[model samples]
Target: MNFILYAVPFFVVLIVLELIVDRWRGVSNYRLADAINSLSTGVLSTTTGLLTKGVGLVTYAFALKHLAVIELSAESAWVWVFAFVLYDLCYYWLHRMGHERNILWAAHSVHHQSEDYNLSTALRQTSTGFLLSWIFYLPMAVLGVPLLVFVSVAALNLLYQFWVHTRHIPKLGWFEWFFVTPSNHRAHHAQNALYMDRNYGGVFIVWDRLFGTYQEEDDNDPAIFGVTTPLASWNPLWANMQFYAQLWNDARRAESLWDKLRIWFMRTGWRPADVAAKYPMAKPDLSQFRKFEVPLDGRQQLYVALQFGVYVALGSYLMNLADSLPTAALVLGWGAVAFGLFAQGAALENRPWAFRLELLRLALNLPLVWLAPLAGLWPASAVAWVGLLSYSLFSVIGLYCCRNRITRLAS
Candidate 1:
C-alpha cells in the first residue's frame, strides 16, 4: 500500500493550516513561486518514482532471499516497533552521507534547494535517490526484517518528517532531546557555518546526539535556509540536474584521470586543484544573502497558479493509475507531465518563451486527450475528451492573455 498517497489530503490540510498560522502571526514564510517550484520537484519525484522504485524493491528482495540469517514475521508488534527504530538508524547514515559525499549530494540536494523553509520544502524530494538509497536498508534485510515491515516503517518515518519543516513550532522542552523536532530540523536546513551539516536524523534525534553531529538551535544565530551553492532558477528539471551538471563539467575539465574518477566520491564541495584554480566558485556571504525572486504581475500569478492546479490534479491521477497503466502509457504520461512542469517553472521564472511553451503544452494536450486513452492510460470516454479539450481551450486563452506580462517581465 502507498501510504504517502493516502496522506496527500492530510499534507494539503496541514500546509493550509500553516498558511493560516503564517497570516495570524503576520509573518510570511511561504512565497507562491518558491512553494510552487518546491511542489513541482515533489510531483516530478513521485512520477519518476513509479518507474524507478523497482530498483530498491528488487535489490532488497534479492538480499533477503540470499542473505537472511533468520525469518522475521510481519505479524509481531515488537517486530514493527523494532523495524521502525532500526530503519531510522539506517536512514541517519544515508542522510549523513547524502550531505557528506558529492555523488549522493547530487541526488539529495533537491530537498535543500528551497530558500524558504516551509511545509512545502518537506515535499521537495529527490527523484534519483532510488539508485543508491536502497543500500542503506540492506542491513535490515540481512537481519531478517520482513519486507512488509521495512516498507511500512520507512513510509512512517518519512511521514513523521513532514511537520518538522516549519518555523511556526518552537522548541518542545524535553521532547527536543529524543525525537526530531521543528527546532532541531530547522538547524539541519540552515546554511550557516554553525549548522552546516548537523542534525541528520530522520525520526530520532538520538542518532545525531550519539554520533556527535547534534547542534542545538540558537536564538542568537538564526537559521538561513538553502545550500551554499544556490539554485537560482525555479525550473524543476534544472533544480534536479544542477549539481550533477557542475560535477560533470568539473570532471571533464580536470587534468588527471584520477581526479576525474574520484571527484564524485570526494567530500561535498571538494573540487580538483586544477579545476578549482581555473573555474573558481565563490560562496555567498550569509550576512548579505538575499532570496532568489522573479517578479510577476497578478494575471501572470493567477495564470501560473491555475495551470499548476491542473498539473497537480493530473499528477494525482497518474499516481493512482500508474500501477495499472501500460508501459507505453506510463512513458507518454510521464513525458507530458515532465514537460508540463518545466513549462510551469519557466512561466514562474517569467521567461519570454514561457508563453509559447505553455501554448504548445495546451495544443499538445488536444491530441493527448485522445491519445492517452488509446495508449491504455484510461478507458476512452466523452467526458475525458471534452473535459480535457475545455481545459486546453481556456488555458490557451489564459496563456494568450499573459503573453504581454511575461514579455514585460522578461524584458
Candidate 2:
C-alpha cells in the first residue's frame, strides 16, 4: 500500500536510465536545481491528491446520488483503448482553454514554469487543476462510460505523457502525424510565439493537428521555454500561485466592477486598457532572454529534496492507516491532510500564516489520539499519535529557528 516505496524506486530507475541516454547522446535539457524543484513539487502533488480529487468526487457523488452511475468492473480492452482517445480529446480542449482563459491558466501555468524540459518536467503537475478540470470529463459520466474505464484510461494517458517530456527525441516520422511525440510535445512546452497556445494534446497529436492549434517545431528559430511572465523563484507554492496572486491584485486594483470580473477571463496576457497603458511591452526576443535553468541556493535545494523524501514516507504510511481506521481514523487522516497543506504552504510562503499552520498541527491531532482508545486499537494508535506529536513539536522548533534567522537577516 506504500505506493511511494515502489513508485520512488521506479522513478529513480527511469531517472537513471534517462541520465544515461542523455549523456550517451550528448543531449541534456536538465539542470540540477530545476530537476529537484520539479520532483519536489510533483511529490507534493501526490501527497495532496486526495484533497484535490476528494472534493470533486464528493460533489459528483452528491449531485449524481439519484442515479447509479460511474460504475465499472469488467471492461473490455477495447473500451480502455477508446477511453484513452476520448479522454485525450477532452484533455486537449481543457489544456487549450487553460491557455485562453486567465483563471484556467492559473492552474495550468504550474506545468510551464520549468525552464528546463526533461523527465522531471513531466512530473510537474498542478494539484489545483481538479477545480474545473473534472467538469470537462463529466460528459463521460453522463454517457455512462463506467468510472473504472475512465480512470484506467486516464492513468494510461498520463503514463504515455511521461516519456514525451524529453528533449532528446526527434520526430517519429509519420507517427508525428498521429501521436504526441517528443517533437510535438516540445512545441507545447515552448514559450516561443510560434509555439505558444498550440499543440494541446495529451496522448495524440491528431487533436492539435485537427484543432488548428498545431505548430511545427522550427529548427531555425529554436524554442524559448518558460512563461511570458516568469516565476523568479524555484518555490513550488509560488509556482502554483504566481498567476493567481497576480490576477487577484489586478481585480483589486481595477476601476469598475465589470473590469474586476472580466480580468479573470481575459486572454493569457491581455490587460485592461488602463492597466496596459502602465505596462507596455515589446515582442519577446528568444535570443535575448536568459537561459532556462534552475534557481536554487545549493543548500535550499538539498533541504527541499530531503523534505520531499519525508513527505513520501509520511503520505505512504497515512494511506495504509486510512484504509483500516474506524470513524476516528478519519480524524487523524484529515489532520495529516491539513498538516500536509500547511507544510507545503509554509515552505512555499514562509510567512506568518505558515507559523500559525505549524502551531495548529498538535491541536489537529489531539482528537485522533483521544478517540483511538475507544476504537480499541491501542498499540498502533499509541505509537502513531506519539510520533505525530513529536514531529509537530519538531516542526514548531524548526519554524522558530527560521523566523529568528529571518529577523536577523532583516535587522
Candidate 3:
C-alpha cells in the first residue's frame, strides 16, 4: 500500500488547520506565495516519483536476491522493531551525507529553499533524490528484511517526521530527548551557525545525540530558517535547478581538470581556490536576513491560488490513475502538471512571460481533452470533457480579467 496516498487528505487538512491556527494565534508561519511554491515542488516531486521510484525498488530487489547474508522472517514483531531502528540509522547517514556533499545538496536543497518553516515546508521534497538515496538502504536488503517490511517501516519513518516541521509545537521536555520533535527538527532546518547540519535523524533523535550532531533549541539564539544562499525566486522548477546550475557554472569556470572533476563531490559549498578568488560568491549578511516576497494585487493572488487548487485536484487524479496509465499518458500528464506549475510560479513572480505561457497552457488543454478519448488515454465521458473544457475556459477568462490587476501591481 502507498501510505502517502492515504495521507494526502490528512496532509491537506493539517495544512489548512495550521493556516487557521496561524490566524487564531496571531503568528505568521504561512506565506501564500511560499506555501504555494512548496506544495508545487511537492506535487512535482510526486509526479516525478511515479517514474523514478522503480529505480529504488529494482535496486533493492537486486541486492536482496544476490547478496543476502541472513534470512529474516517478516512475521516477527521484533524483526519489525529492529528493522525500524535500522532504517532510521541508515536514514541518518543518508540525510547527513545529503547535507555534506555538493552534488547531493543540489538535490536536498529544495526542501530548505522555503524561507518560511511550516507544515507546507515538510512537503517540499526533492524530485532528484532518487539519484542516490536508494544506495543507503541496501543494508536492509542484505539483512534479508522482506521488501514489504522495509517499505512499511520506511513509510512509518516518513510519517513520523511530518509533524516535526511546524513552529506551533514547543519543546516537550522528556519527549524531545528521545524523538525528533518539532524543536529538534526546527534546529535542523536552521541556517544559524550553531544549528546548520545538526540533527539528521528522521524519527529518533538518539542517533544525533549519540553521534554528537544534536543541538538543543536555544532561547537566546532563535532558529532562523532557510539556506545560507537564498533561492530568491518563486519558480518551483528553478528551485530544483538552481543549485545544480551553480555547481555547473563553478565547474565550467575552474581552471584545472582536477578541480572540475572534484567540484561536484567536494564538501558542500566548497569552491576551487582559483574559482573562489576570481568568481567569488557573496554571502548574505546574517543580521540582515530577510524572507523573499513580491507585491501582488488581490486578484492576482486569488487567481494563482485557484489555479494551484486545480493543479492539486489534477495531481490527485493523476496519482490515482498512475499505476494504470500507459507510459505515454503518464508522460503527457506529467508534462501538463510541470507546465502548470511553471506557469503558476511565473505568475506568482509577476514575470512578463507568465501571461503568454498561461495562455498557451489554456489553449493546449482544449486539444488534450479533445484527443484524450480518441487516444484512449482518458475515459470516454461527456462530464470529463466538459470539466476539462470548463476549467480551461474559466482559466483563460480569469487570466483575461486579471491583466489590469497584474499591470497595476507591476506599476
Candidate 4:
C-alpha cells in the first residue's frame, strides 16, 4: 500500500503546523536554502531507492517470499509488545553501527548534514538504509509475527522517532529511564563528543539505558549539530556524494594495500599511519565549539512556513496525478516536474546562473508539459493541452517575477 507515500499527508500537516506555531528554537536551524537543498537531496535519495526497490522485489520474490517461514503466534498481545521492543533493540544497534562504521556512515550521514533540524529533518531520511535495515526485522518474520503486526509496529516505531528530532522539549525526570524522549534524542543529534554515538534507540530509551549507552541531555553542554566535516556547499548531488567521496580519497591515498582494503570497515575515523601524522588528528576542542543559533529574523520563519507548505502541496498533487494517469504519464510528466524542482534549487543557489535558468523554465513549461502531454496540437486532446498550458503560463509568469526581483537585488 506504500504507507510511506500515504504518510506525506501527515508530513504536510506537521510542516504547516510547525510554521503556524512559529517555533524559533525548534526551527532555529531551518532556513529556506537548507530546506530547499535538503529536500532536493531527499528527492534524489528517494529516486535512487526506487531504482533499488527492484532489487528488493527480486529478493522478496525469489528468496524471502515463502509464506511457510513465517509463524504468527496467536496466544498473546505480549508478543506484539515484545516485537515492538525487539524492533527498537535492532534499530539501536543499526543506529549505533551507522555512527561507528564509515561505510554505513556514508549513506547515513546524509540525514545529519543538515545544520538545522526541523520537519525537513524528518524527510531527510536515508533511502539507502534499506540495504541493511530490513535484516534487523527478520527475527520478527521468523517468529511468525504476522506481517501485518510486524509492519504496524515498524510504522509505529518509525512514527514515534519523528517527534524526538526537535530542540523544543526538555528533560523528563524518570521518563528518560524508559521511553526515548525528545531530550534524549537532542543529545543524539548533538555534534559534541560526549553525546556522539550515545542514545541509539528508535522508540525506547530503555534499550540505551539498559545497554549502558545512554547519556543525559546536559543543559551545560549544548549541541553543535552537523558533521565535523561541513556540507558547506548547497548542491544536492554533492550532499549525497560528500562522505563517500571523502572515503574514496582516503582509500586512494592510503600507504599500503592492506590500508586501502581496511579503510571501509575500520573504526570510522581511522586513517593510515603516515596520513594520520601528516593530517595529525586534532583532538576536538569542545571549548572552541558552541551551540548553533539561527540568526534569521523572526519573519523569515513565516516565509519558510508558507513556501515549504506550498512545495509540499505541489509535490503531493504531482504524485496524485502520477497515480491517476498511466505509467507513462508518471515517467514523462511527474519526472519532468521533479527534475525541474531540482534544477530550480540549483538555479536559486548559483547567483551568477540562477536568473537565466529561471527564465528558461518560465519559457519552456508549455512546450514541456502541454504540447508534450497531449501529443502536440492534435485536436483530440486539445482540452488537456489547455489545462497544462494554463499551468505552464502561470509558472512562467511567476518565474519571470522572481527573476525581476533577483536582478533588482543584484544591481
- Cα error, residue 73 of model 3, in Å, equals 1.8
| lDDT minimum window of 10 residues, candidate 1 | 398-407
**Stronger candidate by lDDT (2 vs 3):** 3
Pick by TM-score: 2 or 3, better one: 3
**Model 4: number of clashes?**
2
Tens-place lDDT per residue, model 3, 1-411, is: 989889999998999899899999999998899999999999999998888889999999999989989888998999999999999999999999999999999999999988999999999999899999999999999999888999999988988888999999999999989899999999999999999999999999999999999999897899989999999898889999999999999999999999999999999999999999999889898799989998877898999999999888878877898888887777777888898899999999988788898899898888888767665568889898889889888888888889966667669
Q: Write the per-residue lDDT of candidate 1 for residues 1-411, one digit (tens) a residue.
A: 999999999999999999999999999999999999999999999988888888999899999999999889999999999899999999999999999999999999999999999999999998888989999999999989998898889999999999999999999999999999999999999999999999999999999999999999999999999999999999999999999999999999999999999999999999999999999999999999999999888898898888888778878988999888898887777888899999999989988787778788888987898788789987899998988899888887777777766568769
lDDT of each: 0.93, 0.70, 0.91, 0.66
RMSD of each: 1.4, 5.3, 1.3, 4.7
Q: Which model, 1 or 2, shows the larger lDDT?
A: 1
Question: What's the lDDT for residue 283 in model 3?
Answer: 82
lDDT of 1: 0.93
Model 4 lDDT tens row, 188-213:
87788889888988888888888789
Clashes of each: 0, 0, 0, 2
Supply candidate 2's per-residue lDDT for 221: 62
TM-scores for all candidates: the values are 0.98, 0.77, 0.97, 0.79
Give one digit per residue, the lDDT tens place, for model 2 in 1-411: 333334556667787888999899897767666775676567556645644556656544443444545543335676566667788998898989999999999999999888888888888878678888877776656545565566666777777888888887887899989988888888888988789899998888898889798888889767777887877665666777889998887777667789889988888876677656665545557677885443333433344455455655655654556446454444444445445544544444344465565556545556656655566334455577877677657656665666566567669
TM match of model 4 to true structure? 0.79
Clashing pairs in 2: none
Number of the top candidate by lDDT? Answer: 1
Candidate 3 regions exceeding 4 Å error are 374-376, 408-411
